[model samples]
Target: MNRKEANQPSPISRRLFFSYAGTSALTATLVLSGCKDDESGMPVDMGVDLGSGDIGVLNYAYALEQLEAAFYTQVIQTKYSGITAEEEQILTDLRDHEVAHRDFFKAALGSAAIANLEVDFSKVDFTNRTSVLSTAKTFEDLGVSAYNGAGQLLTDPNLLLIAGKIVSVEARHAAAIRSLINPKSADFSGDDVVDTNGLDGQMLPDKVLMLASPFVKTKINASNLPTP
Candidate 1:
């Protein structure tokens, strides 16, 4: 059956995490939020659809890239306490890279691109190093997982190649953040995230959205995105 047809209206306080196989080898554990219908029991606007098929996948990437860019931009703006010059420079570079990524997706999607999302950083404490680095780590890891999970959903070879390129960069970002948290060791490829076969973590759009929504003021309706 079409997975989209299986979606049901959700309550404001209720959410779902679905672990299911997609069109190919990649598996997804989606974090679905918001109600599918209104009081009239009719289909309500679920915000941005992210479309369907390959275009939906690109918009998905674009949304996360935008979040990462916004996050790094804020980090650079405040500069956590006792941050070294090297750390500052590296973070600035990360910020630039995220912006480039965000813009790349925006350009690639063109008219099909979703609108610029507003971020909610109210929960983040920018004054503390530990807090900032932890958040960065979370975001990077999420990015890597998101790309991995969404990969097989894209039927377009060129789009998949582009995704491959972006996922590599995201993995690097994840490693860098992990290194910062543990300077003496290479926990970047730790067993917790990477499998024994040497695969990075993967997450469905719903799962990613749950982790990311706290930082984003905008409500995202990702239910309309294509499933495997």
Candidate 2:
């Protein structure tokens, strides 16, 4: 759906669009369908040299999706109070999209994809509405910056296009959630999401995770992520 008519899901629900006809979900399922792998054995190598090409870019996307998926999954498992049905559905959709993103990269990358990241959400008060959304806002914004920053690093045109589509959707999500924070904040393109002079902001994976580390109790080593 277009942004104007985009249906807003409640804080508890997910507000995202998914097409079953698309193969991203299929690819994701295929990627995670095999035997379980250990995080220790696989290691959290954000800079695993994804192969010095598009493979690296795909792997990068996969890593971020893993984090996003983990966070949303936790949110749903321990839902907060004062959550509306609409919000619940939105969060669910958000969770599904993150899952699809995680799976999409996993399937697309095949063996190149990293292992599931164990997130630590000990700092987030799932019972508190503000804490949850604030962290959610950070994630959404980081995802947007990440795609924007990393998109240039992608060697393949098709992969770049795919990342564009996904980041656009993420920007929409960032906008919607900001509205809930404060109506005036809904224009995500404003200083909140964007930077001075209306330029898009950038955040390295390390910095992004450091911001996220507060809520996540899991120890992540993004030191290996490829850099420009």
Clashes of 2: 24
RMSD of each: 12.1, 8.0
Question: What TM-score would every model get versus the actual structure?
Answer: 0.81, 0.71
Q: Write the per-residue lDDT of candidate 2 for residues 1-228, one digit (tens) a residue.
A: 322111222222111212212334223311221232466676432322334355555666676777788788888878999988877778777877777677666655556565665576777788988998988888899889888888777655666778888888788777767776776653656676677677677666667666666655445444344676
Lowest lDDT 10-residue stretch of candidate 1:
12-21
Candidate 1, residues 132-223, lDDT tens digits: the string is 99999989988999999998788866667777877899889888888988989979888888998988879888899998989888788887
Please list the residue runs of candidate 2 whose C-alpha ends up more than 4 Å from where it truly belongs after superposition: 1-51, 184-187, 213-226
Candidate 1 Cα outliers beyond 4 Å, as residue runs:
1-43
RMSD of 2: 8.0
> What's the distance in Å from true for residue 52, model 2?
3.8
Leading candidate by TM-score: 1
